[model samples]
Target chain A: MEILNALINITDKGAGFLHSIPALLIAIPLGAAFLAPILFKLWKRLAEIITGLAVTACLVLAIYLVLFLGNTPIVYTFSGGNWEFIQNLLPLGIVFVVDKLAAFMLLVVSILVFFAYLFGLKYLERFTGLGKYYTLYLLMFTGMIGLVMTGDLFNMFVFMEIAAISSYALVAFGTEPEELEAGFKYMVMGEIASIMILLSIAFIYSSTSTLNLAHLSYAFTQMQTQMASTPGFRAGFYFVLILLMFSFSLKAALVPFHSWLPDAHPSAPAPISALLSGVFIKVLGVYAMVRILYNVYGFSWESSPEVFTALIVLGLASIIAGSLLALNQKDYKRLLAYSSISQVGYIILGFGIGNLFALIGALAHILAHALGKGLLFLTSGSVVYRTGERDLGKLGGGLGKYMPWTSLTYNLGALSVAGIPPFLGFFSKMFIILGAIDLARVWDSDPSKPGWTMIAVAIIAGLFAVVTLGYLLKITNQVFWGKSEEKRTLKESPFIMVFAMVSLVVLLLAGGVAFFFWLKPELLGPAADVLLKGTKYGELVLPGLFGAGG
Target chain B: MLILGISLVLILIGLYAIITKRNMIKVAVGFALMEYAVNFLFAIIGFHKVPGMKIIPPILMEVKTTANVLSSYSDPVPQALVLTSIVIGLGVTAFMLSLALRIYNRIGSFDLDEIKRLKG
Candidate 1:
């Protein structure tokens, strides 16, 4: 009764502002997406303008939300909006908890979506159904934003499905055989991953009797205490953890489970590909992994050594395997897709190292990779648009001669992803490798232990770095620098596309230099703190839901 | 228990069909079978055994205010989730069927091996 009173009091104090922000974030684009087709019927230009404005407004709103709740978490609850039946049945219908981490993710997603939509204005002209494309794109945007903000497990799954299904359709938008095949393969793998997630949720719900993440975390803590000595329960927990890790890793396309990405990413149109590689994988896979590990399962290296080892092993495998795969790819988009796998490996490795510096590196890498890879894919799209060629071997000639702006941005993007200094990627890689070394030093006192494994992984990461540099340079030389034997007909892409590419390049460089001043404390610090104090997350989220005193 | 066992068997059969079937349509049907098996499992998970489960009362009568009312209300959450999942499955299946039809139209075959535009 007292707890309920406290909750009511809290709501009364801040419910008006807090409750509306998340809904506004989700509803604006979703409503725009829905109205886009109708608006297109009346005036086609209005559809793009409305969507671009909606996304930009969302970006600004997210930035404001982040600044407003700097280093502080905001919890908002909506009890079915005065619907009597729902209110009576499910008193606590749904809640959205938007902390700094969610706000940061929302910012990243909205910015990317805004740019992608702007680019789509010109790029989507060739496609038959422009209105339908924007509609699906807006739906995808809503799902990602909602996924980041929602604090319920089932709601997250629903949002994830929304995003995944829309992406599958977008990938197959071309209706060509390759696109269809890629979409089919992507759907199959995605369905399997979703099933795994559903099964895991079913197990968790049956065990905890709740779907609210905060409540579930509370239940998990109580279960842990009561069954601390029970080996069977511990084993079951580990099994569920592995299930989640596997499912999320599949979504992230970490090496062994990465067969679908190279196909699916290359098959999608440029803007869609940008979304897929830039933010889709991060939201679906990396964000969920971080949330579950930090807030739900309460895992860290010091507490759960086995889980940490699993993460490290998987990250290393992806790094090495993705690099090797990229070395052999001749298709331009497929090569970029492989590089995405490798970059994701770097992010996962940073998280797996389980330190503050590593977490910062991981977050920074997500931001940088999104910009760099997004630019690369968009540039490739422009290249394909102008030349109608995807094979690297068939098309080679001074692209820089024809499209100077695109070549410049593409070079900057490649250099960034390859971790060249003065680009965004280098700072992130440096921090992550330094964190690994620090962790190794911490574990070195015990000579019989495998502390040297970190050093070995670090070396492998370095070697992969060189491999990435080699391929990126090879691509640059082949496509942009060398002259073709045959006469190649190429022209610069439309102004809008070039503008989008250039802006992203500028943002990437600026973000790289101003990492400390801009992103660190606002985004990275709080996220790292959440991960570092993993189990305390339960206490923070479910303050009155557990223990004897309650 | 019997329902659970049957659903497990159905899933195994679906898996077998998926692995052994050469026709794309058959493979798609196998996927449907698997989805049905999963849905059945979910429904079974929500089901509770009880006596006097049905009540045919007047339209506007006193509601049953018994302990059984609370105890016998099956897990409606999973049921709702399953309904949504079934609809999603239907959408995906329809899309796949159309895709298969398109492939057949283009390639003039139902054999999966012959419709191989994408390869390593």
Candidate 2:
């Protein structure tokens, strides 16, 4: 009975000091990042300790926020303790809104960052310039957290650049010829994308006369309803929206704009690769795009069917193209990177379907991929660390016999990613397929069109899931089932690496089995609700104006 | 409208260099050009040149009262935005230049075609 009361209290909306934790979430990391180099000069141990402590603290706060924002959003204004007055001038001050979606993302990113830091502690020992690596890594961490939490559009752009620039530097940290080339390519593409986004933001600011997300949403809605909307105004708004889509698609690595990802992901350090492949694209590219479209611009299938159709087409293309490309990769990390692109297609398709189940599926896929793909990358890194090999042809066959723990974890990861039953990926893929069918039914509201295209696309996506399994199983078979190549004995990875992989594997299994029972109600359901609410999100974040008027 | 068109043309020129240039330093210069174009556009967006009002700087010391300063001075917001964007552009340019230098050191050339060791 006492435990039940505590559980209820945990779910209740927090007040006072807890409300301020969102700011500290970004601040702690940013502060520690600046201090890391100075402390490194003092003692190498101190810098590592600070980074670990900062990430762990942020993770605890993230988990706390997830529970605290179960039903309520904390709208924090960065004013001089006079938010009451500034609340009326909503667009003037910088605001950080911690809703269920933001909290969910916070949980996803912090968990990955914390584990990656833990894994990198020993993994990075051989590399020089450890100080710079930790600094840039923390900066990247702070930028992503800020991106998800900021309520200002321009602030999002700023944080996005922070994340992008830091990542470009980290990708080149290896300083290899290939790494530098990949980093330069990524930097150029990323800069162009950011510039396009900035142009859109400028256009938006001109039209709406505000840079705050909530205010812009309110103003855009009002402008849509007003008869003063000219053809030129509509043209400009549509142009800005299209630019935003293109830019974000570039960042998200959705097929036509995904040329940079295959090179950049494989070129970075393995832990950074995991961070990039697992969460970076999702947060910087997918999450920001969704927020802008669904919440800021108020996208609905009934209202903007063309936009939804565009999303579906791009997603289908990515699903097919990314999978086919992954089949031809010789390098282990590049194959995984291409697979990341393919998995992201499922997310985009689910979101484009725009049903409750599909949105839930998309969010679930994000968590599943974060764990499964991150584990795969870490295991691959461990293999390389043990025996400096990245080629598939040279390092295969009976190696699994020597390192049974790594083999088991890799197989589990492969199984989960391939959507095997009772694993996390299976449930996410099931919901997405179901959601696609539901979308087809709704889209066929006009009797003339049968909506077979969407159904076919769903079928094709499932077939591609088979392709995913084919490739993953091929790796497993090639690596584990053949004759042993190395003459010396191989041992399991150290405890730190094993602990990281084991935690991810455990979560992946538990999420799959307990998805409907606990995960949905506690996490995924609320997150999808936030997306489904659409422009009603504006009211939730800023209650002074447009209160409860959907 | 003319200013916007000029800014668009400048952007196109920069993009042409970015897409067609093979030298890494040329690409970096192209990026700088694009950055400046955007900054110019931002300046035009915030420019307030009312014909009848007396022009003044945004600083309060230049004006006697609040009303005159409000009507005559520039909006200042876009200027601030341009300043911040310029700084960000500088950082990106510096980082890109450093990366280009490292690539040159690695391959002993600045041409991008020679740096194709990472192809599929």
Model number with the top lDDT: 2
**lDDT of all predictions:** 0.80, 0.86
Q: How many clashes (backbone N, Cα, C below 3 Å) per candidate?
A: 0, 0
lDDT string for model 1 (A160-237, tens) is: 988988898899888887787788778767766776677677667666767877676667767867568988777778
Error of 2 at A64 (Å): 0.5
What DockQ class does candidate 1 belong to?
Answer: acceptable
Off by over 4 Å in 2: A1-14, A80-83, A226-229, A547-550, B53-73
TM-score of each: 0.91, 0.95
* CA deviation > 4 Å runs, candidate 1: A1-19, A81-91, A226-232, A446-448, A487-489, A546-550, B1-9, B15-22, B50-72
- What's the distance in Å from true for residue A93, model 2? 2.1
List the DockQ of the predictions in order.
0.38, 0.70
Error of 1 at A386 (Å): 1.1
Q: What is the TM-score of chain A alone in each candidate?
A: 0.94, 0.95
Interface RMSD of each: 2.0, 0.9
Per-residue C-alpha lDDT of model 2 across residues A261-334, encoded as one tens digit per residue: 99999888889999999999999999999999999988898788889888888788888899999998778888
Q: Alpha carbon lDDT of residue B110, candidate 2?
A: 93
